[model samples]
Target chain A: MKAAIFEHAGKMVVEDVAKPQIQAPDDVLIKVIRTCVCGSDLWSYKEGDHKQAHSMNDGHEALGIIEEVGEGITDLKVGDFVIAPFTHGCGQCAGCKDGFDGTCDNHPAPTNWGGGYQAQYIRFHYANWALIKVPGKPEDYSEEMMKSLLTLADVMATGYHAAFCARVKKGDKVVVIGDGAVGQSAVIAAKMMGASRIVLMSRHEDRQKLALESGATDIVEERGEEGIAKVREILGGPADAALECVGKQAAFEQAVGVLRSGGRLGYVGVPHEDNLNLWELFSHNIQVAGGSASVTTHVKNVLLDAVLKGEINPGRVFTQTYSLDEIDQAYKDMADRKTIKSYVIVD
Target chain B: MKAAIFEHAGKMVVEDVAKPQIQAPDDVLIKVIRTCVCGSDLWSYKEGDHKQAHSMNDGHEALGIIEEVGEGITDLKVGDFVIAPFTHGCGQCAGCKDGFDGTCDNHPAPTNWGGGYQAQYIRFHYANWALIKVPGKPEDYSEEMMKSLLTLADVMATGYHAAFCARVKKGDKVVVIGDGAVGQSAVIAAKMMGASRIVLMSRHEDRQKLALESGATDIVEERGEEGIAKVREILGGPADAALECVGKQAAFEQAVGVLRSGGRLGYVGVPHEDNLNLWELFSHNIQVAGGSASVTTHVKNVLLDAVLKGEINPGRVFTQTYSLDEIDQAYKDMADRKTIKSYVIVD
Candidate 1:
C-alpha cells in the first residue's frame, strides 16, 4: 500500500507501506476509494507534532469500500461503500453519549495515517460503530463531488458541529470568522439551522460570495477591532452567537468582541497563540469553547445521507482535485490556498 | 433619606442623602421593603473595583413597595408590594429582548442606594420592566425565611441561571463548585431541573450534607485536583455540566477539570483573580461564562412565585438575622461563616 507519511519536519512523501491488518475482532479493512487533505493535517505537518515519536500518517477525511470484515464486524460486510468517520470511536462512551466522540476514551486512533489519507488498504477498529454505509445517490451525481463530501468526514462536520455548538437557531444573527472550508460550511449549517441573519468576515471576495450564497446575509472585510465593530454596526448590536472558525488568538479576541453580552460563541479554530483575557469572557458572559470536531459523535451517517439526498453540495468546496499519485501536490495546493480543497482519487 | 455610603475602603456610614424622585415617565418610588448583603457589596465596601469613583452606594439586591409611581407608570401604583429588579431595563431594547437587561444602555439603576444593600428607599425606573409584584404567601412562612427567599432578587436567581445557562436537563449529571449560597442554591435548582447526578465539592461536612439534601447524589470533600479526581471516581467520567460558583483561578480550573469534553459550565461566582489558562479551557472545550446574574429577567419572579405557590421552599438558605442596628455584627457573623446567610431587619 502507498500511504502519505510524514518523513521529516516540513516534509512528506507517498511511500509504499505494509498493508494494515484487522487486529481487533470488531475491525475491518477498507480499500481506499477517495481521500482529501485537511487543515488539521497541515497544523502539525509544517511543525512536526508527532514527528519525533513515529511516522505520522496524514489525512483524516476518507471514504472507501470495505474489502474485508473481522469476525465481530456484523453491521457491515465486504464491498460495502462507506464513509470512515473522521475519528475511530466506540458508539458508546460518556463523551460519545454526549455527542462528543473526539474526546471518547474508547476510540482508537492511528499509530501514524490511521487509515485517513492513505492508499490501497488500512484497518479500522470498532468498524460497526465507526464506518457509515454511504447511501446511494442519483446516477448523475459526480463521484468527484461525492469524494469532496469526504471532507464532511471532518471539516464539514466540524463546521456544522461548530454552528450547532454555537446554538444557532431560528432568526438568529450569527457571525462566522475565517474563510476556510469549515467557515464556509458553518455558513451553510447556520442557514440550514434557520439563522435569518448570517454574516461572514472574509478578505477573499470569492469566498465572501460563496459565503453569501451559502446563506451568509452579510460580509465584513475588516479584521481585528475594525472587523468586530463593523459586525456590531451592521447587526445594530453584537450577534446572538459568534462562530470563531479561525483559531488564531486575534480571531478569538475579535469573536469575543463582536458578541452581545450573554451571547454564545462556538469556536472551532485551533489557536496558533493562546494568550486571552479570562476577565473579558467573564464580564461579557460569553460561553467560549473549541477543540477537535467531534464529527463522528455528531453526524457521521447523517451528513453522508444529506449528501446522498443532495441537500448539501459539498463538492463545490473542492476547487481542485488530483489523482492519488498527485496527493503531495494536493497538500501544497491546500496549504498555499491555491485550492479551497483538493480531492484524491484512490480507486 | 439616609444611606450607608462609602466614605473610603472599609469605611461606610449612614449619611443623609437626598431621597430619589421619579424622573422617568415609567418610574416608581419604592420604599425599600427588604435588602440583603452580597459578596460584590464587599468589593465596593472595601474599595476594590477601580471604577469606584462615586461615593459608592453598595448592595445589588432588594425588595421594596411602590410608594409612588410616575404619571405614566400604569402597572405599578401606591402600596403595591414588589421586588425591585435591579436592572432598570427598558423592556423594548435588544438586550432586554435577549433576556439580558443588565447590559441595557437605558438601564436606570438605584440612584438612591447605588446598588441594593442600603437603608430607606429607592426610585425604580422602568418600573414596568424593573419590578415584579410579590404574590401572597402562606401565613406560616416566617419573615426571616422570606428575607432569604428575597435573595431570589440576585443570588438565588444567579445560581439557577447558571444551571439554566448550561442547559441542564433532566437526568443530566451536574457538578457544582463553591458552597456559598449560590452553590447551595445551584444544587437546589439542579434538583428542580431534574438532574439525577449532582456532585458538590466542599470540605465542610455540614455544607456537604446540605448539598446532599439539596439534591447532590454525591459529595467530594476536596478542592482542586483531589476534588476533580473524586468527582471522576464518583461518576466514572466527568459531569455533563459543571457550575462554577466560586470565582477564582483555582476554582475555575477545578470546574474545568470535572467536565466531560462537551460539558456546559455556568459560572456565577465573581472571581477576584484574573489568571485563567485560556488554552486549557479552549482545548478541553469547556464552556466558560459569567456576568452579573440576569436575575430580574425571569428567575426572581419564577422562584418567588413558586415559593408563594408552595411549589418550592427556598427559605432555608438563611442561617441568621439581626436588626438594622446590629449590621456590624451581621457582617461579622456572615464573614465568619457562622451562618449560611445573614439578614438585616430594616422595618
Candidate 2:
C-alpha cells in the first residue's frame, strides 16, 4: 500500500507502507478515496525535528469506502461510503451520547494505530461511532458534491461547532477571523444560523471572494488594530459575536477587541500560545467558548443534507488537488500559503 | 473630614483629609453613611510598595446620603440615600444599555475622584450613573438593612453576575469555589436562581456555616484534586456549572476540572494569573464567562428588591464592623483572614 509519511520538517514523501487491517471487534478497514491537508498539519511541517529519524502519519481528515467490517458492526456493511472525522469516539460513552464525541471517555486521546488518512488503506476503530455514512451511492453525486460532503468530516463541522457553541442567533452581527478553510466554513455556519451580517477578516483577494460566496456580508483586509478598526467602522459598532479561527495571540486579541460588551467569542483554532489574558476578557464581559469540535453523527447529518441540497458549498475551500505522488507539493503549497487547502485524491 | 488612606503594604490609617466638593456638572457630594472592605482591596494591602510616599484611596463599596448635587443633577436630591458600586458607567453608553456597565464606552475605567468610600464626604462623578437610590429614607431602614443593601453595590451584585453570566437555570447542580463573602453570595445567588443542589468549597467552619446559611446544600472542604474528587463523589458526576469566586490559578483549574463536558464556568474574582490554559478549556467544550461584572442599574434594581423583600441577606457577609478610627484594624483583620468581610460605619 502507498501512504503519505511525514519525514521531517518541510518534508513529506509517498512511499510503500504496510496496509491497515481490522484489529478491534468494531473496526472497519476502508480504502482511502479522498483526503485533504489541514492547516494544523503545517505546525508539524514547520517545526518538527528533521533529524529525528521518525516517519509519522500525515493527515486527520479523509473519506473512503469500507472494504471490510469487524464482527461487532451492525448498522454499516461492506462498500459503504463513509467520512472519518479528525478524531474518533466510542458511540456509547456519556460524552458521545451528549454530543461531545471529540472528548469521548472511551477513546480519550488520539492513537497511532491507523497510519494517516492520506494512505491507500486504514483501519478505523470504533467504526460505528467514528464513521458517518453518506446517504446516496457514490455514482449519484458529482465530484464537486462529493468534495463538499467530505468537509462534513472536520472543517465544516469545526466551523459549525464555533457558531453552535457561541449560540449564534438570528440578527447577530458576527465577525470571523482568519481566511483559512475553517474560517470560510465559519462564515457559512454563521449565515446558516441566521446571523444578520458576517464580517470576514481576510487579506487575500482569493479568500475574500470565497468568504463572500460563503455568506460573508463584509470583508476587512486589515490585520490587528487596523483590521479591528475596519470591522468596527463597517459595522458602526462591535459585533455581537466573533469566531476566532486563527490561534495566534494577535488574532485572539483582535477577535475579542472587536466584540461588543458581553459578546461571545468562539475559537476553533489549535492554540499556539500558552495563555490568553483573562483580565482583558474579564473586563469586557466577553465569554470564550468552543474547543476541538465534537462533530457527532447528528452534526454531520445536518451538514451533509445542506451540502447535498446545495445550500452551502464548503468544497470551494479546496482550491487545489493532487495525486498521491504529488503529496510533497501539496504540503509545500499549503505550508507556503499558496493554497487555501489541498486535496489528495488517493483512490 | 477624615478618610482611610492606604499608606503602604499592610498599612492603613484614618487621617484628616480635605472634604470633597462637586467638581463636575454631574458630580454629587455625599456623606458616606456605610462602607465595606472588598476582597480586591486586599491585593493592594498585601503587595503594594512599602516605601512609596504617597497615600491612596482604599474603599469602593459604600452607601451614603446625598449632601449636595451638581447643576446637572435632576432625578436625585440632596437628601436622597444611595449606594455606589465599585465602578461607575454613563447610563447612555451602548455598553451600559446592554447591561455591561463596567465596560461603558463613556467611562471605560474606574476613576479616583471619590477618594474611596472610607471618607466622611466623597464627591461622586456621574452621580446619576454611579449611584443607586435606596428607595426609602435613611431613617426608615435599620443599620442591618443598610449594610445588606450596600452589598448590592458590589459583592452580591458580583455573585449574581457570575450565576447570571453562567446562565444557571432551574435544577442545575452548581459548584462554587471559594467561601469568601462573594462566594457565599454566589451560593445565595445560585439558590435564588433555583439550582437543585449548591456545592460550596469551604474549609473554615465560619465560612462553611455562612455558605450553608446562604443556601449551600453541600460543602466540600478539600482543595485541589481531593476537593474535585469529593465533589464528584457527592454529586455522582461533575457539576452542571461552576462559579470560580477565587482568582488563584488552582482555584480556576479546579472549577474547570469539576465541570461536566459542555458545562459553563462563570468567574467574578479579579484574576491574579495572566492566562488560563485554552487547551484544557477547549477539550471539554466548557464556556467561560463573567468579567468585572457589568452590574448596571437594571441588575441592581432587581437585586435590591430581592434584598428588601428578605429573599436574600447578602448583608450577613459583613461579619464585623468598625469605626473610621479603627480602619487599620479592619484592614489587618481582613488581611489576616480573621473576618469574611468588614464594614465601616462612617456615620
Candidate 3:
C-alpha cells in the first residue's frame, strides 16, 4: 500500500508501507477515498527540526469505504462509506458519553486511528464511535459533494465546534479571524447558527471572496490594529461574538479586541503563543472558549444532513487536488500559501 | 470632617479634611456608616513606595446613609441607606444597559466615586446607578446585618459575579481557589446557585472554618501541585467549575488545573501575570471568564433580598472593626494577614 510518511522536516514521501490490520474487536479497515492538507501540518513542515519530525502517518481527515470490520462492530458493515474524526474515542467512556471524545478516558493512550488516512487503506479503532457513516452511495455524489463530505472529518466539524463553544446565537454580530479553510467554514457555521451579521478579517482577495460566499456580510482586510479599527468601523462597536480560527497571538488579540464587553470568543486555532494576557479578558468580562474540537457523533450527524441537503458547500475550500504520488507538491502548495487547502485522492 | 488618607505607601492617617461635595448632577453625598479594607487594596499598601501613594479617601466598599442627592438623582433620597459598588457607570450607556458597568462608554473618565469611602462623608458619582438603596432605615438593621450589606458593595457581588460568569449550573462540583473574603463569598454564592459540592483551597484554619460555614463541603490545605493533588484525591478528578479569587499566577494555575476537561472558570482576582498559557486552556477545552465585577442594580437587589432574608451572611468575612482614628491599625492588620478583612465605622 502506498502511504504518505513524514521522512524529514519539510519533506514527505509516498512509499510502499504495510497495510493496517485490525487488532481490536472494535477496529475497522477502510480504503481511503479522499484526504487533504490541514494548516496545522505546516507547524512541523516549516520547523524542519529533527525533534519535530514525525515518521507516523500524516493526515487526520479522511472519507473512505469500509473494507473489513471486526466482530465487536455491530452497527457498521463492510462496503459502507464513512468519515473519521481527527481524534478517535471509545464510545463507552465517560468522556465520550459526555460528548468530549477528544479526552476519552477508556482509550487513555494515543487513540488516533493507527494508520494515517492519506494512504491506500487505514485501520480505525473504536469503529462505531469514531466513524460517521455517510448515508448515500459513493457513486451518486458528485466530486464536489464528495469533497464537502470529506470536510466533516475535521475542518467543518471544527468550525462548527467553535461556533458552538462561543454560543453563537441568532442576531449576534460575529467576527471571524483568519481566511483559511477553517475560517471559511466558521463563516458558514456562524451563518448556519443564525448570526445576524458576519465579519471576516482577511487580507487576501481570493479568501475574502470565499468568505463572503460562505456568508460573511463584511470584510476587514487590514492587519493588527488597523484590522481591528476597520472592524469597529463596520460594526459601529465591538462584535457580540468572535471566532478565532488563526491560532497566532496577533489573531487572538484582534479577536479579543473586536468583541464587546461581556462577549464570548470561541477559538479553534492551534495556539503558537505560550502566554495570553488574561487581564485584558478580565477587565472586559470576556469569555474565551474552544479548544481541540471533540466533534461528537451529534455534531457530525447534523453537519452530514446539511452537506447532503446542499445547505453548505465547504468543499470550495479545496482549491487544488493531487494524486498519492504528488503528496509532496500538495503539501508544498499549502505550505507556500498558494492554496487554501489541497486534496489527495486515493483508492 | 476626618477621613483616612494614604499619606505614604505603608502609612494611613485619619486627619481633618474637607468633606466631599457633589460635583455632578447625579452625585450624592453619603454619610459612610461602614467601610472595609479589601485584599486588592493590599497591592498598594504592601508596595510601601512613595510613587504608589494615594492620598484620596482609602476605601471602596461602603454602606452609608444618603446625606444629600443632586438634582438629577430622583430615585434615591436623603437618609436612605445605600451601598456603592466599587466602579460606577452612567446607567444610560450601552454597556451599562447591558449590565456591564465596568466597560460603560459614557462618563468613562475614571468614573469610580471621586473620593473613596473611608471618611465621614463621601461623594458618589452616578449615584442612582452606582448606589443600591438597602431598602430600610439604618437604625432598623443590626450592625452585623449592616456589615453584610456593605459586602454587597464589593466582595459578595464580586463572588456572585464569578459564579455567574462561570455559569455554575445545578449539581456542579465547584472549586474556589482563594479563601479570603471574596473566596468565602464565592462558596456561599456557589451553594446559593445549587452547586452539589464546593471545595475551598485554603491553608488557614480560620479561613477553612469560615469556608465550611459559608458552604464549602471540602478543603484542600496544600498549595500548588500538592493542593491540586489533594483536590484530585478528594474528587477523583477535576471539578466542573473553578473560581479564581486570588490574582497570583500560582492561584490561577491551580484553579485551571482543578477544572475538568471542558470545565469553565470564572476569575475575579486582579491578574499579576501579563500572560496566560492559552495552550493549556485550548488543549483541555476549558472556558475562562470573569472581570472586574460590574454589579448592576439587579444583582445587588437580588443579593439584598438574600441578605435581608438571612439566607446568607457575607459579613462574617469581616473579623474585626476599627474606628476612624484606628484606620492605620486596620490597614496594618489586614496587610499582615492578621484578619481576613477589617471594617471601619465612621459617623
Among these predictions, the greatest DockQ belongs to 3
Between candidates 1 and 3, the DockQ winner:
3
Per-residue lDDT over B1-347 for candidate 3, one digit per residue giving the tens place of the 0 to 100 score: 88888878788888788888989899899888888888887777778533445576448888888888999998999989888778786777556666667655565563333346788888888888777887768889898998888898889988987898898989888999888999999999999999999999988999999999888999888888999888878987778899999888898899888876678899998887767888788877788988877776435657888989999999999999999889889999988878899988876
Best to worst by lDDT, what's the order? Answer: 3, 2, 1
Q: For residue A43, what is the lDDT in candidate 3?
A: 70
> On lDDT, who's better, 1 or 3?
3
- In candidate 3, position B98 carries an lDDT of 62
Residue-level lDDT for A254 in candidate 2:
95
Measured with C-alpha atoms, the lDDT of residue A217 in candidate 3 is: 99
Order of the predicted models by TM-score, top scorer first: 3, 2, 1
- Cα lDDT tens digits for candidate 2, B129-201: 7688888787899878888888987888889888887889898999999899889889998998899999999
Which 10-residue window of candidate 3 chain A scores lowest in summed lDDT?
Answer: A106-115
- What is the C-alpha lDDT profile of model 1 across A30-124, one tens digit per residue? 88777887776777666765555247466777777888899988889888877776666576877666776655545443211243455667777
The backbone clash count of each candidate, in order, is 5, 0, 1
Name the runs in model 2 displaced over 4 angstroms: A49-54, A91-98, A110-115, A297-301, B49-54, B108-115
Itemize residue pairs with steric clashes in candidate 2: none
Model 1 stretches with alpha carbons more than 4 Å out: A7-10, A45-54, A108-116, A136-141, B6-12, B43-54, B70-72, B105-116, B136-141, B275-285
Chain B fold agreement for model 3, TM-score: 0.95
TM-score of candidate 3 against the unseen true structure: 0.95
